[model samples]
Target chain A: MSGSGPGPTAVPTARRGRRTVDLPDLVARARAGEARAVARLISLVEDASPAVREVAAALAPHTVRARVIGLTGAPGVGKSTTTTALVRAYRQAGQRVGVLAVDPSSPFSGGALLGDRVRMQDHAGDAGVYIRSMASRGHLGGLAWATPQALRVLDAAGCDVVLVETVGVGQSELEIASLADTTLVLLAPGMGDGIQAAKAGILEVADVLVVNKADRDGADQTVRDLRAMLTLGERRDGAWRPPVCRTVATRGGGEGVAALVEAIDEHRRWLDSSGERARRRVERAAREIEAIALAGLRERMGEVRGSVALGALAEAVVAGETDPFRAADVLLAQL
Target chain B: MSGSGPGPTAVPTARRGRRTVDLPDLVARARAGEARAVARLISLVEDASPAVREVAAALAPHTVRARVIGLTGAPGVGKSTTTTALVRAYRQAGQRVGVLAVDPSSPFSGGALLGDRVRMQDHAGDAGVYIRSMASRGHLGGLAWATPQALRVLDAAGCDVVLVETVGVGQSELEIASLADTTLVLLAPGMGDGIQAAKAGILEVADVLVVNKADRDGADQTVRDLRAMLTLGERRDGAWRPPVCRTVATRGGGEGVAALVEAIDEHRRWLDSSGERARRRVERAAREIEAIALAGLRERMGEVRGSVALGALAEAVVAGETDPFRAADVLLAQL
Candidate 1:
């Protein structure tokens, strides 16, 4: 595969019979800021296609280090609205943006159908914007394995900032935090989200705390509650404390969006100045590599699952002749 | 480890500095109907202790093929009440019973708190019943890695029946279904649980559908909705259709308890007659073996994670000289 080499003058298509995917040409188009090519690349990644390794290798040299901002909260915290506002704010600054709405809990890709369409349609005509929704229906490693590849696609496609939005529940919250440079944990007033967030351990992952729908009742009380929670933790003298910002995302003309953007920018500055950006990037890369290796090992195990050796071991276990741990050792030895 | 064989009069205790655990004696006592020994064996499994392999090996020959029944539903669905009632009925029949309340979402082992304490107190004095709560706080593979070992502990302790109850949510619902011989998906009336169950794909795993809180209003509506949903799917000839049962669990005189037990017995007969019991057992054992193997592989990867080879690869990826897939391949080759 590496012998093909990646360059503009190289053969674009490696044809396998009648089916053809010009991965090199596709990567070239995506790097040239073509939305269709970018969407197709993301589709390949989401599908876990056989050529994904080739695509990744092709896109590696084009990565521009796009800023990744993760937005997560409970189901009804105005995540889509806040995301729309952020997109508009970024577009106003003439920056290309990509959005990946990852739903690890849902088996279907219907995240775009639930009152999010109208907001997302605002970016439908922009050539500089690419939006996609990925569901964890068939993924073996689920969101943790897929999201980073999608993010890499956006970064190599010349996006200045890529926003990843997901429901803040269970393991997905922490998974998102690990993949992003700046993590925003969104909440709203009168939703009892403060207690739930704390219980979920969502507070520790936040680089910015966003209280969307700030015009609603008890917004002040919500901000005060967040402040109280923040003060309970001790930080080093120069450590970056997550800033709590309030926004009425439904208001016309993007009310309170400027301050939120400024907060993100400030966090980015801190990350760069403290050498935390390089550190986080290296850690994320390490995790991505580890996930891929584990996935390969799992695939190998799945292949061995149908072998007579495993069948005999399983039968021995069922017959009470051997324990699972011993059977596992035998199976691993065979692998 | 196998050099020390299990026997009646073999050396019981294996001393390691300040700690001593007698695996053969513990298994012997557990098989002779000692509740404390059973509890200690399960604690070893829960803690993922080094002696767990020995415990599993020692307990293998004493397996009694206990009936594994899984109870799962959303919170506030009276799971604890039904569990207590089932325990009472089983004990009244003079059968030894065990209950495992596995909470995969909670970081704390407080499954016995809330209103469950009052119901659980009814069984505190019974020697034939053993009840314990396990939280998936520190396990690398969550409930999937830990639950089966705990179940094995109970099964080898000569319990005629073991009830495994868990909150029916995203992944845990499916995990519980995989571990049970008979899975009861519980629903309560007027809770909007029907739609949620359908969305979570919880209905497909049920061998028995239970509508608890049968005395409440809308009980008939919930049952009808469940029946309507069930009929939408097609089943093959001789296939066992899940029976929908109603039970007012809080009522005195074990309301509907006899009928529920009868239904479970009927399902068990079908499983035996159709050879599915053996099939399920073999499949369950296969899964347990696979989970153990994957966990062992994960530990090896974790060890390699701190090595300089992985660090260099991660740095190369961050510098855009390599992709994660290629880095993962290099790491796996090193392994």
Candidate 2:
């Protein structure tokens, strides 16, 4: 309730009413590959702008074209490095690329050790590449609620490819999988005893497994451990058995990275031919729409959080005069 | 549209009046320390039954007596084992204990290796111990939505303390922290290089850090690493520093279990004396109420998901005739 409030008043402050009627031109510019337009649209989504409906409506037709790829791994697994490498590959293929570093550890904490942005500066000057860091900390609904809309903005902005990178902690990877056509789960050598992988449930979400930092000690062991795990996973035939690839993303030496690209492309082909693409799209849309609606409801509840009606209901329920269900009913009806 | 729809009809399938008028009986039974009643009420909440509001209203006054403790760790950290040990200790202290294991890894398989239940069967026969396994796999909104309701039932059921254990993957641990007065973060020796602690953001949420399986090799190193990280966290003066304790839970050994309990008690005392308890409870209630409202809104969206209005709006957005924000507005307005 501290952050969320009732109805339109709960719209993010930055999004209150900067440009409610200029959505069509913005969408037009975004579709024509305007970076500022693209950035502005993403800002609107991030801010939960009231004009978001107009923005989404205007941009929907231009979307469903970009090939969205999600890259996730444990922290310190070179996800940002791998993402930058992939962005280079896509750019080299003459495709405009967009990168959404979801939940970046600290892009906001600009300092000498700002490794993420520093390492990804290869395309800093390339007009064909757009790199954006999304902080889930302040965003309503966190990554799951915010990423899809950001992706939509990217897709509609005429990016031929969009790569989403998230740390594989908790539901972040699953959320990434739901949004990405190709999900690359990265691991590194000697990072752990492979216990985290099993615990993290990364096995279920990977379309491609990349053992990044392949030049490090125990790279083979890590790859073997992952392969053994995948085999134990016993993915039925015809299911995508995630292929394991190794890469030294730091050197940019193209060790198994091209093969990784090929794997991603093959996955794209499979998705298209098997109609999984459409299915995923529909599912993504459903989740996105549901999140938006939920966000709205949460806002309404925020307004009602400390209201007299809600407080009395809580008190009644707390005092055992009524149950929470009935109390909620009265509260909801009041809202 | 495939899953979400327009309005209240979409609330949840189980809530379509399975037993709308039997609220008072269920509430009474639950409050009177009936396990079956408690379970039934939780089932209603989980199923998003229409009677949930009544259940909440009925049970509200009898709640807030139980101290909720959250236990979480990476897989293989002996969370279930530690929880069993704690339950043994609490029972010795003559307190009713309830355990809610969120995100049981294999609730879907319904096969063996339901490790949590299997491991926690030590207290299975004790009437003083009520252990329930929550399957987040099938539950909507995962831990965020289902957990608070379950906790309420446990609290109202006269459990002096409820222990909520979640797999420390993704956002589960954070959710637990929000609900618990004290959060215990479990770790094991030789599990990883301790990088996960930083990546998982476990350092922030931990109220008590237990190095489980401390008898194993690298136990000292793990504890040292955790302590070092804690020191690096740089708590200001008067900040409660999470103390790292060692335990060999499998041995049912009393190495640091008592100290851990003391730490939990001390944390609870701090919570109460610092006014954090009231703040946390309010925040928890706010989250619970908001989740319920959002659940309702989601149900409504489900009703509208495939409806003509929703389909047309989706189509309109897809065709770029309108933007998603505007379309969502129309959808919400219709609801």
Leading candidate by DockQ: 1
Candidate 1 C-alpha lDDT tens digits along B1-335: 11132222111112124257888898888778776677677777776789889987887765538899999998888888888888888878898888888877776553334434554456655667767777765455677777788888887777899998988876888888888999999999998556677777888999999999999999999999898888887999888899989998889955898899989999999999999888888878888888889888988998998689988998998888998899999998877
Pick the TM-score winner.
1
Model 1 per-residue lDDT tens digits across residues A94-168: 998888888776765533345345644566556667677777554556777778888888888888999999888
Q: Model 2 misses residue B302 by how many Å? A: 6.7
Which 10 consecutive positions of candidate 2 chain A have the poorest summed lDDT?
A: A2-11
Q: What TM-score does each of the candidates earn?
A: 0.78, 0.60
**Global lDDT for candidate 2?**
0.72
